[model samples]
Target: MDIKTASALHRLRLISVPEALSFPALLIFGSVLSRVSDIDFLMMPLGVLHGILFVIYGVMLLDVWVKAKWPFKKVLFFFVLSLIPFGGLYGDKVLKREEADSVVAARAREAAQA
Candidate 1:
């Protein structure tokens, strides 16, 4: 809802997406095993990176949920969204739209109070 929350979520969303997508691509590459053992071994690293990024994504989602005090359904949707391919990107877009809406509402409230 706040700019800081929006900004942090934006970054987490960006980071997690590429990490998650890389996992399956790397796995596929490993399976292909095109004559290079080292290349095939990269799968382990990819899995590690994806795991870490996924944890970070979860943390970021929780941060946003707490800051925005969003309803349970919205929070659940956000968690579910992160599991799909490029889901983080979609989550980022949704969060940004919500952030913009919050900004507009804030401005309106200020005007009203004045």
Candidate 2:
């Protein structure tokens, strides 16, 4: 893959962490603290931030999926994974492993060519 295509994966992986956390943070602020804090004021901003991040993450994921030519099942799995709290950490790990494997494969190709 070209650097741009591969870098899309890296971008998606980076956004996954913040996007994952934002949802739970929204939940806690929106639901759990609905009664306890007067900071109900924070709810809208948190929700908006989460919404924006969620959309951005989805877009980045789509970009990566297309560039990487991932299977529908794999794309669906990652989409579902993003919905679960803290699932991004797991996703990050998986992406790292895949990145490592791709790097090794690319190196092997280069070695063979040389």
Candidate 3:
């Protein structure tokens, strides 16, 4: 992948954690916390924020899928992970390893060319 696409993937890796957290947080606030306290008002704002984060995640996911030529199954796996609580932690590690592997491959290519 090109530098821009790689950078986008890097950003997505970073966002995965927060996006993952937001889903659970939103659920807790809307379902459990809201009924017990006045913080119910906070649900709307949190939901909106989560929505924005999710959209950003989706956009980056699509961008990486296209640019990185990731397989459909891999793309779907990442998407499903975003839906599960704390799944981003595992995803981040996987993405980190993927990034490291790609970097190593790129360097090997350059060395071969040289």
Output the number of the TM-score-best candidate: 3
lDDT of each prediction vs. the true structure?
0.69, 0.82, 0.83
**Across residues 1-114, which tens digit of lDDT does each residue of candidate 1 receive?**
455655655665666566556556655566567455546666677677777877877887777777777789998887787677666667777767776787776677768879
Give residue 7's lDDT in candidate 3 (0 to 100).
73
The estimated TM-scores of all candidates read 0.70, 0.86, 0.87
Q: What are the clashing pairs of model 1?
A: none
Checking candidate 3 for backbone clashes, the offending pairs are: none
Candidate with the larger TM-score of 1 and 3: 3
Provide the lowest-lDDT 10-residue window in model 2. Answer: 1-10
lDDT of 2 by residue, 1-114 (tens): 545655777888889899889888776758678678666777788888888988998999999888888899998988998999988878988887766666676677778889
- Backbone clash count for every predicted candidate, in the order shown: 0, 0, 0
Give the range where candidate 1 is weakest over 10 consecutive residues by summed lDDT.
34-43
Candidate scoring better on lDDT of 1 and 2: 2
Best by lDDT: 3
Cα error, residue 59 of model 1, in Å, equals 0.5
